[model samples]
Target: MARSFTPKVVTANRLIQGDTVWLTANGYWSSDICEAEFITDAGTAELRMIDTETQAHLVAGAYLADAVMGEKGPKPIHFREDFRTRGPSNYAHGKQAEKVEKNV
Candidate 1:
């Protein structure tokens, strides 16, 4: 028996900055996962991944990653993807630092 296709989003890392990015419906990349284009069909998701790969200069490691449609947008379905959304875990650097610096 065949399993149904789960929702997904095309994801990649910016070639220069190496920051995680997701493909938007406008055929562009955004650092915010909430802007990702939610694909509910496996075939469509695969096609999106291929299309995203054509922009080699803009991004790399382009691939279709599992996701679920949320009220805001697509959310990561796996631990790795969820972890990536939070930026780095360092308490003194990255997203964490930005929050701390703002509160000071």
Candidate 2:
């Protein structure tokens, strides 16, 4: 029997800034995973990956990541993806910085 398809979201690192980004429903790349398009089927995930991969100049390491629906939006299912959502770990910068500033 064929393996069941798991829900996923397309993700990659922006080539210019190296920030982790997800493919939104409108085809825009968003830094927030909550804004990601949650893909439920294997066929749609494959097609999305094919289109996303073609944008090599804008992004790198594009792939489908396991995710689930959240109260706010899609959420990452894996530790690696969850870590990526937090931006760089070395310091407070990028998304992390923005979040810190907002909390103050």
Candidate 3:
């Protein structure tokens, strides 16, 4: 039997800055995972993948990531995707840096 489709979110790295980004409902790429568009339909997910292809100038390695709807928005289903949302792990920069600054 075929596996049932799980909800997904479109993710990629910004081509120039290498920031992790997700496709939003408005068609813009957002660095925040919570702003990602959560797609539950297999067809819609495939269609979104196609849309990502057209945005090659802005992003790279575009693919669907399993996700679930959360109070804030889409939440990643795997450790890898969760790690991506935190930005670079190299000594606190990017999203990690901003978090540190905010807590100061």
Candidate with maximal TM-score: 3
lDDT of all predictions, in order shown?
0.77, 0.84, 0.84
lDDT of 1 by residue, 1-104 (tens): 55898888888877987767888888888877888889988778778867875799889898888998889899999998987766756554443243311110
Off by over 4 Å in 1: 92-104
Model 3 lDDT-worst window of ten: 95-104
Q: In model 1, where is the ten-residue run with the lowest total lDDT?
A: 95-104
Indicate the worst ten consecutive residues by lDDT in candidate 2.
95-104
Report lDDT (Cα) of residue 41, candidate 3.
Answer: 86
RMSD of 1: 5.1
Candidate order, TM-score descending: 3, 2, 1
- Compose the digit string of candidate 2's lDDT tens values, residues 1-104: 65898899999988987778888888888888888899999889989998986789878999999999999899999988888888678887667666422110
Q: Flag the better candidate by TM-score, 2 or 3.
A: 3
lDDT of 3 by residue, 1-104 (tens): 65799999999988987778889888988888888889988989889998988899999999999999999999998998988888567677677565322110
Measured by TM-score, how close is model 3 to the native structure? 0.86
